[model samples]
Structures are given as C-alpha cells and as structure tokens.
Target chain A: MGASSPDLIVHVDTFARVNMVYEVLSVISVIMLLAASLAVLITYNWRVCVLSLAVQYLAAFWLINLDYPLAMAAVKLVVGWMVCAMLGATPVDLKQPDEQLPGRLFRLLASAMVWILVFSIAPSVLQWVPTGMVILWGGLALIGMGLLQIGMTTFAPRIVVGLLTILSGFEILYSVLESSVLVVGLLAIVNLGMALAGSYLMTVSGGLEV
Target chain B: MNAPLIWIVFPVIVSVILFFLSARRYLVVGLATGSNLFFVLLGLLLPIDRLIKLGPWAFEVSSTLMVFGRKFVITDSDAHLVVFLYFFAAFWFFGAGVVRAHRLFIPIGQCMVAIAVAAISVEPFLYAGLLIEVAVLLSVPMLVPPGRRVGQGVLRYLIFQTLALPFVLYAGWVSAGVEANPANQRLLQQGVVLLGLGFAFWLAVFPFHSWVPILVGEAQPYVSGFLLSLLQTVVLLLMLGFLDSFAWLRDFSVLSQVLQLVGTIMVASAGIMAAFQRDVARLFGQAVILESGFALLALSVPGYQGAEVFAGFFAGRLLALALWALALSNLAADGISFGFDHLKGLLHRLPLTSIAVVLSVFSIAGLPLLASFPVRLMLFDRLIPEAVNAVIWVMIGCLGMLMGGIRTMMVVAHSQEGWRFEERLPPAILMAIGLLGLVIIGIFPRWIMPYLIQLLDPFQSLGVLMILPLI
Candidate 1:
C-alpha cells in the first residue's frame, strides 16, 4: 500500500514536482485544521460546530495523505464525517449565555498558547514519529486544540466534537507507524460508538433539564 | 468446538438473546443464570484435547480458535478461571433477580463478562485494552439507565476508562521494541511506566478513585456492585497476566514494594473516608476501594502465595459485596433514601435486611466469623514480619471500617416508638442464605482454596514461585 521505487525512479523529476505540490497542500490543510478547531471552540451553535467538524475531517484527510495512502486516509476521513453527521443529527440546545468580548479574547489567547506549545514540541517529537514535520505538527496541534475544547465545555456536542478531533490526531500519527486494517476498523467502530453515546447523553441531559 | 466458541462466542450469543427478551424480566434472569451455570459445569467437566465418551458419543474440545490472523486460546490450565468467572456471573445474575434491578442488567452484564473473558484470553494481550474499552462502553447504558440524567460519576468513569486505552496500546508498542533490544533500559522504563498508568486507571488507584464513590452514589446499588466486582476482577487478572507474560516486569525488584505502598494508601484513605461517609450508598463505594487495596496487598506478597491470597480475598469480597448490594437494593425499593437522615430507626421495619447490611459491612471489615476474616488474617500474618508499617496501616483501615459498622448498627437499631417488625418472605430468605454463606466460608475457607490455587496454574512462568505451599 505504498509507492514503488520503480514508479518514482522512472520519473524522478516529475515525482519531485508532485512532492512539492503535496507539501504545499499539506501546509494549507494544517491551517484549515486549526481554523476548524478554533471555530468549534469559539461557537455555541450546533450547525457551526458540525460544519467545522466536517472541515476538520477534510483537512485531516489531506494531512494523513502526506504519509498514508489515499485509501487508508479515506478510512479515517469517512469515520470522522460519520461521527460528525451523527452528532449533528442530535438536538443539542446549548443554553450557554452570551459571552462578553473579554471571554472571547481569553479563549483566543488560550488557543494561541496551545498552538505555540504544539509548534515548540513538534520539532523534538518529529525525530521519533515516523512522519513528516508538517503532518506531525498538524496532528499535535489538532490534539492540543481538541483537548482545550474538551476541557472548556460540558455541552455534549462540543465534547463529542472534541473527542473526534483528538481521535483524528491520534489516527494521523498512528497511521505513520502502523497500517493494519484491523486496527483502523476497530478505531472506526470506537469513533462511531462514541458519537452514538454522546448523542444519547445529549438527549438524556436535555430531557432531564426539561 | 473450540474453547473460544464455547466460552466467548456462546456467551455473547446468549447475551444478544437475552437483550431481545429483556421485557420478560424473569425469563431473562433465569436464562442468564442457567447459561452461566451451564458454562461453569462445562468448564469443570469437559476435558480439552482429550476425547470423552458421553452416552455413546465421543467428543473433544480444541483449545485455540484463530480469527483474522489472531489466536484466542483457552487451555486446560484456564479451566479454573473459566469456571470461576462463569460462577460469578451466575451469582450476579441470580442476585439481580432477587434485587429486581433494571431488566437490562442481566443481558448487558452477561456481555460484559464475555468480553472480559475474551480480554484475558486474547493473544498479543494488548488487544485486551481495546476489548476492555468496548466493555466499558457497553456499561454506560447500565450505569445511567434510560430516562435518567447522566451523572458526573458516569461521565468521569467513561472518560477515565477510555483514557487507559492509548496508554495500554502505546505500552504494547514499546514492549515489542523492548523485546527486540532487551538491554535497552529506556524502552523498558517507558513500557513499565505506560503499563503502570494503564493499570492504575483500570483499577481506579488513588487519586483516580474519586469516581468510585460518585458512581455508587448515583447508580443503583446492585448495578454498581456488579460492575465494580466484574471489572476489578478482570483487571486484576489482566495485571497478573501482564506480569506472567514479561519476565522483566515480574523480576523488577521494586515492584512488590511499590504495590505495597499503593495498597497501603488505598486501604488507609478508603477506611478513613468510609468512617466519615453519611451516605449509605457511598459507604458501599468505600468498601469497594478497601477491597481493591486488599487485592493489591495480596499481589504484593511474594511467590504463588500472593496468587492464593488474591483468589481468597476476591472470593470473600464477591460474596460480601453481593449481600451488601442486595440489602441496599431492597432498601432503595422501599423508597428509602440512602442518606443517614432517612435511615434512622429502620431496623424495626426491615429487620432481616438491616442485619444483612450490617453483617455485610462487618464481613468486609474482616470481623470474626465472616467471609473476609480468614483471608484478611492470612494477609496480615504474611505481611507483618516483612512490612510492619503496611500491617499497621491495614489494621487502622480495618478499625475505621469497624467503627463505621458500629455506628450504622447503632443508628438502624434505635427502633422507632411505633415501628413494627415487618419482614417479607423472599428477601428474608435470600438475606439469611447470603449471611449464612459468608459465615460458612469464613469457618471453612479451605473448601474453596484448592479451586482458588488451581487458578494459578496457567502462569507457568510463576512455577518457581508456586513451590511454596499456598495455605
């Protein structure tokens, strides 16, 4: 499930050009990943959260494709989107009151700090992880932001999205080392199951409040 | 039939059937109990890898079943464990009926047991982490029943249990590297730390144990008891299996000392907390924490004697917990709040149940002539000379629990002025039988020691440790 040397060797110059394009795409995807994470953290609307989650999955696919084959990367992308759809279908009425400018500013500052932390540590982590620097930093950033989202909210949909983000980051890093189909399938099940549990809890919590 | 088919697949099938028939509460309970008993008998009587004639038909069971390039093996040596797990399932299912718990308890509880068995039996044991996660996921519905608000305890329990997965998987990955480069101390240390963190989360060790009381406080007493007993037993067995599988891990010199330290903290803190708890349900949680502490101490004891101590302690605690949970469930059914304020002078209205509840606490606290006493004595006798401080802390924990029991007895037995001594037929009989079983086991623990020791046979690497007489 990888590119053969003969295919690369036959058109070395062309392969190099394609690799440069892939590198640019990977960088762009990482930016989108962070943007989606920020959207989920800053917004209280479920629709906005769902849309950002979809963007996160799309960006994760491109980031994962930097190391993993397109097919393997698609497995993660599909599972992420399925989880997003499941969560979106649930009726989560986030009753969070209006946040003042100071609250928004504080959240933004916290997220920036997380980004700095990830960027600082990714260089050292890249030595051990079996992936390119771009993929590693992107995965680490997603994980850090996901953790922030989870820690900041008790609302079920946001927490579920946060969980998905964390899992996506792990999958990106794990794919670089192990490419077992069984592991991928099991992880997919975990993602879907987690989404279902989140949806159930959301409804139950809502019902109890009513 | 292969062992996996018999032990794993069959039980899973039964669970699915029970789930569909959940509306028929009695039938579901009866079927679950009957199936568990059948498996226990099968484990005891069937000879794997050897033909046995039964009424003109000859058959032999295979020990291994391969699925998707992975092997699930259950050998002759695992017979005792298989029997014990199934017997526990039967005991739990039977009590579920007596307590009239949620109808889904038997079905989901059956599945949880099967997955736990599979977790222990799975090859390349790291997969057990994922299996355990699945079991934890299955428990959510049971923990927070339908139409109920999800409590912080349930959420925290899920989060903590899920958090163990990555640690375990990473440990498995690193351990493979250690196997390749045995001299690499860095890899060894990393694997040990990761594995330790994973087990600590799984077992709910100190600082991670806040969920225990919260969970028991919110969930039904019977469900919480069943979940705690089942998960703790499996996780402890998995920890033992980890040690047995890796010689480096087992031979780590400081391992026993570390275990003793953790065990001491759990015992002391839980005991002190139990004494202060005003909520009856939370007291049950404290007892569970104390039970985990004792289990750790049992593991800390050197040689196969540790294994014997663990099995005996586990057996006694299981009985004690079942009785305690049953009594609590009956009280809850009577519309009584578990808080101290509501429990005053209730012994007159519920004489047998009150006795069972107090007796169960005393049993767990290691009072004389109760189930846990003999094992507690064995553990203390073994540890006193080697770790005197540990002995002192354990005694202090036991004393705290005894004090709590005395206070509870005094409160319940105050006897309201106009209260009548009322008792129902079924619960009275059940509580009496449970209390009687505790006493008999305390007096004749030897009846179960042979079976308990047999559970140690699967870890062939521990053969050197097994040279010591278990009793």
Candidate 2:
C-alpha cells in the first residue's frame, strides 16, 4: 500500500498512481464544475451560488494537479469560489420559467466545460503516458460527458454540444501530439468566439434570464 | 511584402475599412469586393514564400497572412487552389452588397476568405483539422436561420466536424511517425482509421451526413452556397493536400478502401433521400452531400490521375453549386415555396431559375457531356475495378438521383398554373455563367485538366504517374 511497494497489485508506478488519482479528482471536479456551471446557467440561485464557485475551484485544483505537481490546485478553486461567493451575496434570479431552467443550466455548464476541456484538459493530456491511448480515452470521455449533458437536458443543447464536440477534437489533437502551438492557439480563439456567439444566441432566444 | 501575409491581412484591413464606411453601402461593397478580387489576383501572382516582416511579425501573401505567430505558407502547388477560394469569396461579397443587413455578409465573408487563405497555405498534413474548426465556426451564423430552430444544422455541423477533426488530426499525428519509419503497422492502421473518419465527417459522408440537409434547410441560400461550394472546394484541396504531402496517406490501401466504401454509401443514400425529399432546400443539400462524397472518394483513390480528376471535378462542382444556390436563394426570397405541392407550374413562371436548376441537376447527375461527366467517369472507372460492389452501388444511386431530378422538375412545372407571374425573374447573368461553365468544361474536359495537372505536377511521383495510364 505504501508508495515504494512494487508488490502492490496495481501496475501503476507512484507517479502514474498520482496521475491516476489526479485524473479521478479531475473527473470529480469536472462533475462539480458541470453542476456549478449548470446552476449558474439554470438560475442565479443564491443558495446554490456558493456551491458553483466551490466546484470551479475544485476543478482547477484537480486540473492543476495533473501537471505541475507542486502547482497550487486551489488557485482556480479560490477564483471560482470567489466569483460564486459574489454572485451568492447578491443573487440574480434569471427569473426564467422553472420548467426551462434545467435545460438552460445544462447548456451553460456544457459550454463552460467545453472551454475547460480545450484550454485545460486537452493540453494536459500531452503529459500522460501512452499518449495516444490517453488522448483517445480523454476525447471519448469528453464526448460522453457532452452527450450525457445534452441527453439530460432539453434546452438549446446544440451550442454546448458543438463546443463539447470541439473539445473532443482537441483531445484527439493532443493524442496525436499535434502540439502545434499555433493550431492550439487558433482553436482557443475559435472556441471563445463560439462561446460568445452561443451566449448571444441564448440572449436572443430569451433563454438567458439576464 | 510577403504575398501570403498580404493576402490575409488585406482582407481584415478591408473589412475594417468597410465596417467604418457603412454609410456608403455601395462604396463599402465595391471596396470589399475589390479587395477580395485583389486577394484572388494575388493568389495567382505571388510566389509560395513571398514574405514581408514588420518588426517581429512575418507576413506572406500567398494563401494566408501571418501576423504575430500567425504563419501562412502557401506552397507552389496550392497557389491555384488559394486563388479559387478568394475568387469565390469575392463573388459572394459582390452578391452581399445587393442584400439587406450586409453586416453578416461583411464579417463572415472576410473571415471565410481568411480561413480559405489559411487552409490553402498551411502545411496541409499539419493543420487541416484546426482550419476546418475555424471554417465551421465562421459558418455557424450563416448556416442557422435567424431566431428559428436555434442553430439546428449549425450545431449538427459543429458536432460532425468536431468528430471528424480529431480523426484527421490523429491521422496527421500518427503519419508524422512515418518520417521516422515506425516499425509498427498498428500505428499506421490507427492513423488510417482516424483519417477515414475525419474525411467522412468533413465531406458529410453517409450516416455522418445529417448535417448537410439540416444546414441547407436552415441557412440562407447564398451562405449555404458559400459553405457548400466555395468552402468545400478549399476543403477538397486540403484533403488532396494531405495526399500530396503525406506519403503515408497516399500509400494507405486501407484508407483508400474506406473512402470508396464511404463514397458508395453517400451516393446511394443521398440519392434515395433526395427522391423522397419534399423540401427543395433539403434536396439540394442531399445532392451536394452526395457530390461531396464522390469528390472525396475520387481524391482518396491512390494515384495522380485520381487527384487530377478530383481537382477538375471540384472546380466544376464549385461553379455548379454556386449557380444553384444563387437561383435557389432568389426563389426563396421571392416567397417561392420549395415543397413539391407548392412548386407545381413553376417552370412557366420562372424560366431562368428553371433553366439553371435543370442545368445544375444535369451536371450533378453526371449526364453525358456535362461538367460532372468526366469526373464521374474518372472516379467510377478507377474505383469500380478495385471494388465492383461500390460501382454497382453508385450506379444504382445515380438512377435514384436521376429520378429525383425528374420528380422535382415535374412538381415545379405542374405548380405554375395557379400562381401569377408578378415576381421578377432571377438575374440572367448567373444562369449564363452556370450554363457556359458546365458546357465548356464538358465539351473539352482536357482544356482545364492539363493546366490543373501541370499545377499539381509536384504531387505526382513515378508510382502515381504510372497509375495515370492505368486509370
């Protein structure tokens, strides 16, 4: 059970185990992030507001752990939490219909996660062992997550689905070690542009409570 | 100044200049269109690596412009292709000026020109996926109908493209190993599979083709034409670029087989779908999707002859689709219903639109002595010998498409009696262009083929050259 024990049944080395743990933590953090993103999207619920920021912080923590081992995981956590806290203090009820609330929240979360997958998760895949397999698995996971969110919600899921699909592509890009800095940078800009466009769409549709 | 850099920067600069001169609509249109024309001219005139540096930034005016880490490198082989992209963009910008809300037209038009320039200039084996994502994103606003269906086709398109990007990216990534001559055939296999998936998505091959019809249904006719015809032309070149630049891809028999299979399915399914399609826009979408598959299969076949045929065929498709989209959009704007029941007796009412549609359909159907004929013959001739089953599939599909065309004509012609002929006819210029282009290409296929062949000579190896005679 100890870190040095080769006798441990798992084939993973200490670093690998640490990476795996971080991966798990990353998944959990992503789930939380999705929840918070969902909440922020669904309604500016003051009661749930604190949870949203806390989740974003947790996501940053786990994501950072996948790389710079000593890198502070709490940076994103603290930042996300702070944003959430501010929102919680003065909750803005999107005040949209209750029936439509979940769908909106799901879509927003899906979009936010897509960005995270691109800027954060995808690049980190480069650091994993068996790089291609890891990248492939990561892409499949992101795709699965996106689909799950889309299937679970009825709102304008196209925007989120599109973004998620794009992230899945980023995952594949990393798997192939196509770490073309220029390409990644260009994709980043495109993703943000899409997010802006998607937001504009929701606003236009009367889906965004604000 | 670097040709590639100037080519890209000029558009952005022009767009900015035009954005400011919104008060003078015609002037802005003229400026934008003129600048786009200049890009086309530049694409034709510039050397592959013409570059201008402003401090740390390097600019090129071949295919794309690089600014502050932005690198646009159009190879000599890709010069003609880049020029074609700019030409199409210029054409669309001219059309944009005459329409209302030139806002969408200006920004997306400029962005598409940039994307095309980037697409053609970049090292094809390296950056196709990212370029595709950029193009798709740029297309979203245009593809989705305003305030309706909430970006249905755009979203589908985005997802399908996203699915495809990884495949091609991974293929390129794995093929990079070919430089080192990786010992593992498994690596090669993985790369081929990824590429197959990628091209299928990019081309809207069957089963992954839902986006095509949906996009046509939702998008404006003009924008749809740009995306399907001009954008697709560049995309075809990008795919061809992979084959030219990457020996691994050109040599992969398995990958070639997958393309053949995909093409066969696309042609058959699209034809079947079109026969049943009630919506005119969707019918166009299906036809285009099928044509795309045919083009993809043609290019994917392993040889110089196939690639050469693809280039000529693609140019023809570009012209055909552009004319078709213009005519369709004109009809849509005139409150012409696209449904079968609604289109009855339409031939008498709109002579020009009817002629354009008929001509375009003939070209698409690969009828004798039309633009698409030589391309189809080249594709089926090569592909049939390899996979007889695919040939049969395509032949059957061709029949379906033929019937679909007749069905469409019959319905539209029948609907003409009830409605009055108050609406003005579509511009005669576009019809003439479509008719002339197809007829000229059909009568003398070799006229354009030789030039395209010469332009693409750098891609032809001894092995590929050997296959040309065989094809």
Candidate 3:
C-alpha cells in the first residue's frame, strides 16, 4: 500500500474504551513495562536484564494490540522475544563472570528522575501526538528510561537493550499513526539486524577477554 | 530484465554468493569489482524502453520493477548516477586488494552499494532512511575487525545514525499532513524542522560529527575511508532528493542561509582542528569533515549552481580519499603508526606511498595541479561575490589544511643521507597511477565535466550552472 493511504485511521475514543478484559491486561502491561524497564536501568545482572527485557516485550505486545492488528502486534512480540533470546544467549556462550554492580544509588536516582520527567510531561505529549493515554505515557516512559540506560552504560549488551527499548517505544507510537505492511516488515528486519549485530559485538568482546 | 532487478536484486544475490566464497580474497575482490564494472557497462550501453542492437540479440530493458505494491523505477535519466555509483564501488573494491582488507569488506560493501541505490530509487522514498540504517548495521562487523574489542566510536556511530531514523520518518509523517493541509503554517514549520534535524544528524554536521574523527582513529584507515565516502555520498544525495521533493523546503531562504552558516563553521573549525592534529588518522578525519563542509557550501549556493558545485566536489572527494586511504593502509600494514613522530624519516623507506599520501593531502587542501583545485576555485569564485567573509574563512580553512599537509611532508621527509627507497612493485605502481591521475585531472578538469553535468540532469529544475566557467 502507498504510505499516504488514509484508510489506516485510529479511533482513539473506541480504542481507549475497549472491553474490561483488555483494559485490565493493559494496566497490567503498563506496570510490567515500567517495572522491567526500571530493572534494566538499575541492575547489571544478565539474568534479570534478560527476564526484564522479555517481560517488557510481552507487555508491549498487549499495549501495541490496542493500536495495531493482531498479526502486526504479533510481529513485535516475536521479534522482541528473538532479540531477547539472542542477547540472553551471549553471556552464556561466553561463560562471562557475574558483572559487578556499580553506582547503584546513581542509577536509582537517574531512573527516578526520568520517570518523574516522563509522567510530568505525558499530558502535553498526549495532546501533541493525540494517541491514546495508555500509549502516550507508556511509550514515553520506555523511551525516556531507555535513553537513560544508553547514556549511563558502556556495556554493549546494556546498550543494545536500551536501543531495543527505544525502538519498541517508537514502534508503539508509530503503530497508532500508520500500519503499512511494508513498514512493518522493514521494522522487523531492522529489529533482527540490531539483535544480530549486538550479539556479534558481545561475542567479539568476549573473545578479546579470552 | 528491469533496471531495478539488474541494479538491486542481482547485486544482492551476488553478495550472498561472495559471502560464502570470502575465504579466497582475490576471487571475491575480482568478482565484486568485475560485477560493478559490468553494471557500469550495462548502464552506459542499454537504453531503457528502447530496443538495443547487440549482434544477434535485440531487446529492450524495462525501467520499473514492482514488488509488494511499491515501485523501484530507474529511468534513462538516472543512467549517469547508475554508472557513477557502480564505478565508485568498483574503484573501492579494486583498492581493497591493495589494502588487503578483510574479505567481508567486498561482499558487505557490494550489498551496501545495492541497498544505497535502492534507497534512492525506492518510491515513497521515506523508506530510504530505513535502508540506510540497514546499511549502517551491516557496516558494524566490517568496522570492528574480528577478535577486536568494539570501539566507543562505533557505538557512537550507531547511536547517532539510529537517532536520525525517527526524525526522518516523522518528517515523512508530518509531510503527509502538510500535503493534505497546504495552508497550515504550523505543519509546514514542523515538517521543515524535522527534515533539517534528520539530515543534520545524517550528514554529521559540526556538533554531530564527533564520531567521524573517533571512528577514523580507531578503525583501519582504508575501511573507515570507504565507509565515510559511501555514507557521505548517499546521505548528501538523499538530502538533495528531499529538497527536490519538497517545494516548501527548497524555496525556504532560511534553509540556504542555515546551510551556508553551518558550512562555514564546519570548514573553519575542522581546518583549525586539523592544523593542531598530530595523529595522521585524525588528520584524515579532519579532511573528511572539511570535504563535507565544502559539500554543504555547495548546497547553500543559489539556484542550480548549488547542484553543479555539489557534483564537482563529490567527484573530487572520492579520488582524493581513495588515494589518501590507500597510502594510509599501506603504512598501517607496515606497522607504522600515524603519529608524526613515528612517521619521521618514513619517506626514506616507502617513498612512493609517502608521496601519494602527501599529494592526496595537498589535493584536498586545494593546491594547484590537483583534482580538488578546480572545485575549490569554482566554489570560491561563486561565494566571493555573495559573501566575502565566507570566502575569507574558507581560504583560512584551506590554508590550515595546507599547513597540516606541509607538516606531514616535513616529518616524513626527515631522512638520513644514506636513506634508500625500497618498495614492492604493486603498491609502487598503484601509488604512481594515483599520483598521475590527480595531476592529469587537475590540468584537464574538463575531462570530468560532462559526467558532472549529466548528474544535474535528474533534477530538471536545477538548471546547468556555469560550473568551471573558465574551463
């Protein structure tokens, strides 16, 4: 389809007032997104990071479904899970030592600041983008938190996860505005490519250590 | 076969095949270079939608290839660009042999050319941003050699390039809104801002350019040069395409002023920084930044003159960079660090490579009898009448670069009385040819003018400016 097609409209009023079950699931998903994103930012544990990344994607799948079709939403979940798997496998293949937690207080302070900023400006962002409240707050929070993670860390895997989180946030907002199959397919390729490059970088670093 | 199929899919298929055969470096390089040359020949000989006589064969090549409801069209008007890109790829591949870069460079570099071409040719061209990102991703492994730790430069490169994606896509989104509501000043402003930011990041203008010097410092000089050359060319073309596609953007006087201002800053700052740089790799980086500054200057020119200036600057840059990078690569292979101290007396050992490196620097500095001199002279003549301060600052930048080149030459030539020139035949021949090409082009600048003019044909509104009027 041409990118300019007007058929892909978002009925925000109806979408925001979906059935009770979806509403409950969305609430649960938002909480999961926030908690997992916090975990990713605050901790250096590979296991925790991987699990949190997976949970974040699962939550993304539920929230994204509000704006995109089932198939399109599923693509996000599948790609996210695949990326999680690849990132999770790297530390194991390398037999990496447990990472020493550094600057816990600093991380906590930064994460808190980001969360506060995102929540404070969410209403204005919602007005600007005109998407649903759920997506506006959730996507913005993830994006802000991801930027913090990326800025604070030099570790390749952490940076990769941060990139993924940022991309996920964008995908959520973009899904609300346009839903061309071609764009979706291209995004999927991009996600997979990032995952693979991240994995290779981690491997190269691991080999250097040996 | 359609032009898209020939230019896009065929290269991709060949790339994949070359990937498996990458163990044989010579074979991969030969095949990749040969394929690129074949495409150049094809683009020159075949007329789209018209029957061609080839002895026992007569057939017309189609221009459009539709897939997944999107069209990739390469018309006869695009023949010059097709040949330019392929010839560039071939030149890069051929130089890869001299540098002995990793096998992945050939295959991945070939794929990059195809994807970049597709990015420009793809309809609903916003998708070009995504394709460029993919090309960036593929470049990572090649940039970070195997078993080496990934440098901070590569990471920064990734972040900055990724950062551009959203801005570009959003611009496309906002553009749709502006198109629907042509009278909305707010929407027009928003679209213009997003596009400006997007191309700014993509082009690595002054502030966003922290990655260029760093990447050059850490990676192989040859590989980094190839990456810089390819990315800069494609991104500049993409920017031009954006301007061409949007009348509001092209006619915005403020944008031209912004281009001019940014170009001036980049040139002035990069030149000052290059003069103080001790490391040769960083000096090369400065040269790239300077080249990009000239490109932005060209874009700032009024009317179609900007396009002409851009074409000349782009062609000159490719030759200058190839020569510089090849010499740097040879020095690197000889266990030579790019530091001034380390390079002292090196001209005694590798006279040919040293001469090639120094001449390349001088060419970039706009010395007489070199490839870049004509382009620089044209840019100066055009700007002096318009902005004297700009002309003075650009001259200062060029002078700084010339000083840097002189410093390098002095250090390299610091040799004992009994010093001897000893070099392998291949590199010697390559460097000689490179030096000769630079001088010949400098004296006969008009030899390349036809091709540069042809590049202007795609933009119908960009009339043929009096580029190189004296010539």
Best by DockQ: 3
lDDT score, residue B338, model 2? 68
TM-score of 3: 0.93
Put down candidate 2 lDDT per residue, A1-210, tens digits, no spaces.
365555554555666888776566556655554554455344434355345435544543454334432323343334434444443443233344547756666666666665556445544544432443333344444454455544444444334433543353344325245434465455555545554455445544555321
| TM-score of every candidate's chain A | 0.90, 0.42, 0.83
- Kindly list the per-residue Cα lDDT of model 3 for residues A71-183, writing each as its tens digit: 98999999999988988888733223355454766777787888889888988877447777778777887898889977976677777778889888888778887787878
DockQ of candidate 3? 0.46
lDDT of 1 by residue, A46-113 (tens): 78888898999999899878777889889889988988888888877665566656766777899999
Q: What is the DockQ of each candidate?
A: 0.42, 0.26, 0.46
lDDT of 2 by residue, B1-471 (tens): 555656665676776676677667777778877887887776666666567666999765444455445556666655665566667777777765543333565666677677677666665445757776776766666555356445467666766776676567667767777656866677777767677778777777777788788778777777777777766666676676677776766677667777777777888888778778887788889889878878767765776657766766765687677777777776776778667776767777776677677667767878878888877888777777678888888887777777778887777677425644543533556566668888888877877775555445445451343233222
The local distance difference test score of each candidate is 0.84, 0.63, 0.84
> What root-mean-square deviation over C-alphas does model 3 reach?
4.3
Ordered from best to worst DockQ, the candidate numbers read 3, 1, 2
Which lDDT tens digits does candidate 1 get at residues B180-298? 88788877887888898998888899988989989998999999999999999999988888888888887777889989999999999999888887877889999999999999998
